[model samples]
Target: MPTILDIFKDITKLQRCSGNHSEFIAYMQNLSQKLGYICLVDDVHNILCKKENSNAKIVFQSHYDIVCLKENCVPEIIEDEYSLSAKDSTLGADNGIGCSYMIALMYERFDGEFLFTSDEEIGLIGANGLNLPINANFMLNLDSEEEGEICIGCAGGVDIKAIFNNKKIVPNIDNLDLYEISISSLPGGHSGVDIDKNIPNAIKLLIQSIKGCDGKILDISGGERINSIPANAKAIIATKKQPKKLIDNMKIEKIDTKSEHLSIYDDTLLNYLYSFKNGVRELNKELNVVQDSINLALIKTNIDEIVIEFSARSMNNENLKNLKDSTKSDLEKIGCNVNTYGKYPAWNPDINSFTDTILNIYKNINSKASLRAIHAGLECAIFKEKFPNLKIASIGPTIKYPHSKKEIVYKDSINNVFEIVKIIAYNLK
Candidate 1:
């Protein structure tokens, strides 16, 4: 039998980024067959495996997809005494570690179902479109980042995109200088989990720096993933004079490049971006968690249009709806088209017998274990929606800086979590 670290190393070698998890799916299917477990795959490529003649029907769930920060990524493992990370890329330990836990359990012939979902990084796409026949009454979601905290609930989320048509114009002045303005080196983090930390968004900061500048926007682009706080942003502006206010961490360079067709937008766009409400909107004092929040996740200016993306989350469905409706109305007032998609319901906090069983097991191993309800979206919400009767609890190793290039997982935490999972599976009825 392979150890947890050995299985995790194998998982990192596969290309399992969002929308490109076919190879990983194949690998899981092959492994299930080799292990003599009955394997089943759904239309959305969610893999489910079960041992024959298993009386106890518990499901261990983990998504196979990860947020790929770099293109053509072959994850470079950087190991230390305590933890492991990747070189200039995300370690994919967000779900990889969870997948490894499930795989190791399968190798041990655990009497339960193993569920591998797809495209979880992109708003739980597989869970949203899941059509699998599930026989389990309880599910253990292995997607939470922090160890020793069993996640019983998570915030619901929706993707909001606003589009602005670019009004192209010919350059009227010949003496205009092309200056590249950039904001970099910001401590970007997970938009949902880190929104309340007051980290500055690079795109918002860049737009604020050039507020009253006498310049024409040539092009503006930044932000890689909608789920991450943008760390860098750059804009090419044709201006006769540089802006008065210079902010720190912003780089301004003068260039001699000239363009005949420059895309420009009115002050409405800037005002809209500035006026947008970001970060935590409300806190659930009762639950001690974030109740409502929004993230200005991405901004891109193309030849024809400027696209702005946001991720809005709320523990209450009405709050989530109101936030999205208000954002859409605000953008529509400014002549922008808005679209929202990838909406998933929230998983309400519940203290049931199943959760109590898992929590007790976790506490026996680590007496400091606690119950938590995260502000970020989790597939548990989707699972709850589909199987309202199914009891769900999420657990995982400590993963820091997920969805960014600095992601790392603690080796000790993985071993401890694996032990907890094994105990839960063995004692599960």
Candidate 2:
């Protein structure tokens, strides 16, 4: 009998961040038992709950994992008159609201299947490794952010990791002044959906700030996840000449160092990172979406090597492959070892009887509803390949600035979408 807000607030209390969702998985397992449903949990933590007595032929799908900007972050819910958000943290409403809607339908005893996926924020991990059988003929995904649009297709994606191992260790002591340059407080966002927003990447900005310093890099690290645009970066370097403050919004401080050995990398490292394309590459005029894009997501300095990660996406599978291959070749040309994985296929836009029915239902509640495809990756793309005959469509409430601390969801949109979903569950049954 709990309302969707009550359920969402309860969900925020749990620690369900991506790659750290054991607590949320346990909660779903326990909830399915309490609701007298058949719960099947896969190895990758994908949950499928089925209601046997009802004759509904549809399944509701949502990823249970969320993105965390900070380590061990569990956002505290903050609500106003119009929307629900978090206190300086991501609200997890992107898919948490979707999960809440599925739970509400379960409480109503809707005759349908509910699928909760894991590690979606990192990549479509659970959806790609989904081993559980889905007997439903239709799938309704509740992961789309906008309210009035129905998503019929989504872009494919791949994760690339590159490692540079040839750094020179210099034993010169008492040489040049050591300075630590850092960039912070930039507006970071979701790499996939927010690539076109023109938000400044902290790593790129930091590199540009120190590009002319001609400094020997000792240590450099930045970025939070492989799927997010970096908002903070720091580097310690040794320079002979004092560099003037070039860029705003960054700190340049001379620090006293006692270390005897410093690792110095070639200027090509900085040149490659600066020249790398980090945003939308092409536009799909017909779909009015980004045809190809790449995010230089994470960079880290290890004891012996430096590693960089990227998330590449495209609206077509062939374009995705081409992008991945070209990026790999580019990294290899720089004398770095490259690897690519976590690849998912693209979902081509299609409209069938099921989509028409869902579109009609949505248009009834809001006459402005329309069918569209997104540039970001969605689990529906994987489901479409897994079950060729199964019809799939995605819709959700209005969630703004997802995957960032500024994330918020409108209260009215949540309630309106719930009403439409309720009608779909009952009438389809």
Candidate 3:
């Protein structure tokens, strides 16, 4: 079996974003056939590669799809460490890391099947479509970002999708030209856990920019998935002449932490959003590692409307409600109609769980372990619903900045994670 890093490096070379997963699917099949595994690829391109054994079943799941690219980026290994760097496009560590791990597991001289799923970034179509003989209930989800954390519960998420004008419209006056406005920076992250922190929402920012410029917003939209921080966004605007001046004068405010609320382009909302804020880290004084936060994911404008998307997260369910309410309140006050969605439930940790068993196994392997929940939506929610009696846990090597270009996996952490996983897979009765 090849190292997970090597497999990841090879697959990352193929740009398999969302619907464009044919190359990746074919690649996995080629490997399966070469290794003498029974590879079954369904009509929709979902792959199930098996190393035969006739006992209790164990399944490992991961996806091969990624978000669209911003640039033609090739994954580069940094200093031979487990980490990989991409110049312009996202590294796709979100699920690619897990996919690579699953591929390696098939060749790990194991007695199980590795299910390489497709279209998980958009939906759970790969796993959703498969009709396994109900032979396996032991599923190890290898998609978690952090190495130590073993997530048992995950928030359910729904995409809030809308359509505005598709074609660009030219302004009647010469001075009125179309201009694109965007919100970048403001650390994009997983939505459910990060929403409580007072972070900026790019989608909200685009709308505010429209209001601030005294331009009528023909339409608005933001965010791609309820689980991920929107990476790219755009807005088209008709300015009389000073597109430069209009854009330069635009200002954005930090979200408010105390009240868990924010609004775009409203000075009052700004005051409230930034209120009681020592920035995002200090949102909840009690938590040491920032249990909650918010981010403005994307800001874009079309010929008709300025669109913005935001992700809200919190450890406490009540805080999630407060933040949601505050955001709507602020938008309406700005004279903008309010609509919100991409609602995914937060995954709370189980204090008393088989977590201790995994933690001990990791420590015995001279590694680290963590027990925490995330702000993002996970397949755990979908699977747990399907198999209610299943005792589930999630773990993987440390991954940073998934769903963006900055995504990387710690090289050494993979061995540790793999060893721990081996112990769990073999030791599980």
C-alpha TM-score for every candidate:
0.95, 0.96, 0.72
> Global lDDT of each model?
0.85, 0.88, 0.58
Candidate 1 per-residue C-alpha lDDT over 23-122 given as tens digits, one digit per residue, 9 for 90 to 100: 8887888998899798888888888888777665689999998887666576889999999998878888989999999999889877888889998888
By lDDT, the candidates rank as: 2, 1, 3
Candidate 2 Cα errors over 4 Å, as ranges: 171-174, 241-248, 258-261
- Point out the higher-scoring one by TM-score: 1 or 2: 2
Best by lDDT: 2
RMSD of 2: 1.7
Evaluate model 1: give its lDDT: 0.85
What TM-score number comes out for model 3? 0.72
lDDT of 3 by residue, 1-429 (tens): 568777877887886777676788778778877776777778667777775543545677777787544433445434344456566556677788788777776676566667777776655566555554434657777888776777765544433222223333333443433455555544554454445543445455555565455443333345555456654344444544333322332333322222112112323332332332221322444333444455555444454444444455555667667766776666555444556664545455554445677767877765545566654566666555566655567888787766655666677877777777778778764
Which pairs of residues collide in model 2? none
In terms of TM-score, which candidate is strongest?
2
Residue-level lDDT of model 2, residues 1-429, one tens digit each, is 999998999888999889886888788888888888888889999999987564559999999989888878999989999999888888999899999999998887777999999999877999989998798888999999999989999999999999987789787665778899888757688887899999888888777766767677778899887778888888888887665665576889998865677778767778888888789999999998899999988888999788988999999999999999999999988889999988888899989998899889999989999999998999999998889999999999999889888889999999999998887777777
The clash count for each model shown is 0, 0, 37
RMSD (Å) per prediction? 1.9, 1.7, 7.9
